[model samples]
Target: MRDMKRIGNDRVTSIGLGTWGIGGKEFPDYSHDREAIEALRYGIELGINLIDTAEFYGAGHSEELVGEAIKPFDRDELFIVSKIWPTHFGYDSAIKAAKASAKRLGTYIDLYLLHWPGDSFEKIKQTLHALEDLVDEGIIRYIGVSNFDLELLRRSQEVMRRYEIVVNQVKYSLMDRTPEETGLLEYMKKEGMTLMAYTPLEKGILARNKCLEEIGKKYGKTAAQVALNYLIWEDNVVAIPKAIRKEHVKENAGAMGWRLSKEDRERARLCV
Candidate 1:
């Protein structure tokens, strides 16, 4: 597996396996159950220990597949992260959702998160509290939030300060530049919170960016590698780029062995 990073007290692979394609409703479903299991098995062979999914992905079909795929591997070597949907915001729903996710995953989740910051702040707070209780009860190792803005992050942190909230899952990439503009990157880095970069390849848009192409040519890398490297080299940031192809999986992992110089960083920042 690629080198791991410490999120609070837990160790996770730097380049995680984004499970959306294998499990997402919008993406092509696996041709058959074996394809999904084989893809996950391939990811493990490549040292991708972190598999990111949500209860919403295939309505839990993804986690079920993940569980089945990783059954032969040592559970401790994998960093499994799954999310709870926003509709399940109240304490009861939050608790129930966590149990359901755990049941479907067939293993304890390494991290659980609030999928989004929906309308009810009180319900969100109750859900965070319930997650904290789960951690205490040894049901989950860490708790976090996703798709939250600065104000929501501040609000969530107020509740989570007493607990162990280590990461925030968000859409971040060279093509989607909002996270940089909104000051969430700075806030997250300073708070000792890891930024789990979902859609870090911009849903495949960065591969078409001219700026990325130019940078990739300079480094002799693909546009996707350049975009992913931009996030991987930044402090306190990790990305989960989905890939089922062996060549693409290795291409994603290849971004890890180099340092983006100050000039490269400046060029990438200009694109953002």
Candidate 2:
């Protein structure tokens, strides 16, 4: 693992493990708890100390699995993040939901984010304010928003100034360049906010791309590694690629350290 960056007072890994697939029943297939726990432990063994999960994933079963996986490790060595569902918008629900997630996670959540902007803008505002209150109460160290666009990002920024938002989790990958198109990346960079890339592998689509395969072989890397390297190379960008197998977990961690050359990066960008 690399040195953790300061997000507010909390430190975060540049590369994290997205536990959505392993923990959630919404994916390609519902995996067993034992398998998910193995994957999480394998990810930690491979030096991935950041774990991203949500309360809605299997209705809190995901957090339970994450808690068990990291049980043996020193708590400070890991940065655990979880999300509150949009339905829990007001201060009362936000506080209650966060506590439930924390209990299921087996430790204080290092960072907690609003999963999505709910039904109306008013509810979003109320929810954000509630999250900020959680920070003051020592429940969550940092607050963030997910799946928000440029405009919403700016509005959230206005409210988050009270508590200092440190990250924005969004779907970003070689295959999906919507963040780049919508200026979310630039905006986050300008605000000194980390953009956590979920679905960083495009659910393995980039791994099978012919261009990535050819480029990867030249550098003794896998196509998926090539894709991950591209995301981590950008400033303030971090990728959390979900992997169920140990070999794939090791492969994803290989994305650290070395970076693609400027020409190769541009080529990969074009391909993506």
User: TM-score of model 2 relative to the true fold?
Assistant: 0.94
Q: In model 1, where do residues sit more than 4 Å from their true spots?
A: 24-32, 270-272
- Per-residue CA lDDT of candidate 1, range 32-135, in tens? 55766787788788787888888988878888888898999999988899999989988889889998999998999999989998899998899999999888
Model 2: per-residue Cα lDDT over 1-272, one tens digit each: 56355566666666788888565675434557778789889888877888999998888888998999999999888888899899888878888999899999888888898898877887778778888888888778888889988898888778754877788899999889888998999988888888999998888899888898878887898889899888888778888887767788888888876778888888898776
Q: Specify the poorest-scoring 10-residue window by lDDT in model 1.
A: 23-32
Q: Each prediction's TM-score against the native? A: 0.92, 0.94
True lDDT of residue 30, candidate 2: 52
- In model 1, what lDDT does residue 228 have? 86
Worst 10 residues of 2 by lDDT: 22-31
